[model samples]
Target: MKTFKSILAAILIVGTAGFLMSCESELESKGTASIGVTDAAVDAENISGVYLKVNEVQATAQGKTKTVVAFDSPKTFNVMDYQSGATYDLGEGQIDAGSYSELRFILDEGSYVKFKDGTTADLDVPSGTTSGYKVKGDYEINSDSRTNLVVDIDLRKAFVKTGSGEYKLRSTARIVNKDRSAVINGTVSGNTADKVVVYAYEKGTYKESETAEPADGESRFENSINSAVVANGQFTMAYMEEGEYDLIAVAYDENPEEDTYAFRSASEVDMMVAGSLLSVLKVEANANINVLINLDF
Candidate 1:
């Protein structure tokens, strides 16, 4: 009877060891990946929200692509509400450990924009729902580690007006590992911050036009290095890399077709870095950049 009991105990120990080994092996098979979606500053007057349905998020690895995680049911997001560095976390999932080169978003149809004037317009996609909007960036996934990837949607540039009261969708996305990106936020208070169009040009960007026939420095051809709409006097331009930029604020004189615009710069602020929130002065990683735009037009 004692011998039988010893044999049973050994069997149980062996079974437990096998189960533990199997669990560890399964855990090492994949890595944790979390993705977040955010929007850049979008200034559209009386525009309450721009909504789109995200079908799926795909990742490309070693010349092959797969859906890391997907919304079982399509998820709709208001791009305007997500502005000012606000982000929507898509949660985390496990993916094979490796280097990923590209991230693609399948933005399906059923997109629309709401105006505060009690009007709604359907956002048209030139290509329909056939293709996915892609942002190319590199990221690595290691075993038992978290890889955070962020995708910033620039609504100001993405939503383009066509002919009449219609608009076409052309997505312009910026993908970055959370560690390498930063946000720049501020308030443009003065005559009309909502009417102001702010531009953030690189350090070496020209104060003078590089092309001829330059119309008062703020040429349509010049194109500010980075531009965003000042919504209700509050604005934010996210995903600015680590570098210096010159801020140029412009308030246009009413006429929609008129080219007349007023330019204004802050009293004592110019340069900023990435990874932290900047209010008025510079912080370690990000910054909040407030510009009191006194438009004298």
Candidate 2:
């Protein structure tokens, strides 16, 4: 009986060792996926903050969705704080090494916008709490390595003001592998308008409807891949994937009575037309290209 007990104990020890080995092997096959959030400048005036409450960040690979960052409680982020190539680190976690096709943020309730007049309005995120916000991109995760991703929430196209003066979040965001993206730096000269916005659209993707006035609770330039607010005659559209883009420069005039900026007519610029093509840019991974929009020409 003593001999039999000894054999049983040895078998148990072997099984435990095998289990640990399997766990270690599984861990070794995983890689870390880190995520962050950022925003392009909003075109509206008097908006001091655009806040979003995120409960989880997810990555989808091969039709499977896995959480990269799961907060114990909802985390509130002022997306405007991260602009012009800046990012707010969401979190990171181990995921199976492979190619991921999409990234998304599951938002919580209580999201709102703060105006400069000391007033705050709740932002209605349609299906944000349930379906979440999705950004499509191609990302690769190698075993034992870390992949960093940035979700560009182009607020200029996402924030919509309805006829009732209520605000809504209609995000048109994109995800980029931070390590494998490019930047477009540009300078716009002879733009005397109150404000200028540069939009980057995929080559051959610009449509006439994008330039027209949008319907109530909608936004123009909603199909743009990204945008940059021309500040001090300079703009930077960062985190773009390797591809060709058509840059469109638009001019705006401030209407203080309405507390907003109106799209300036192309006739106002005379020789320099607004909403004209600035350039057709082709970029590769990690490329930094500078372009000059000389409207004075």
TM values, all candidates: 0.66, 0.83
lDDT of each candidate versus the true structure: 0.63, 0.82
Report residue 183 deviation for candidate 1 (angstroms).
3.5
Residue 297, model 1: Cα distance from true site in angstroms:
6.7
What lDDT score is found at residue 54 in candidate 2? 93
Candidate 1: worst-modelled 10 consecutive residues by lDDT: 212-221
Predicted model with the maximum lDDT = 2
Model 2, which residues run further than 4 Å from truth? Answer: 1-25, 265-279
What does candidate 2 score in Cα RMSD to the true structure?
Answer: 5.2
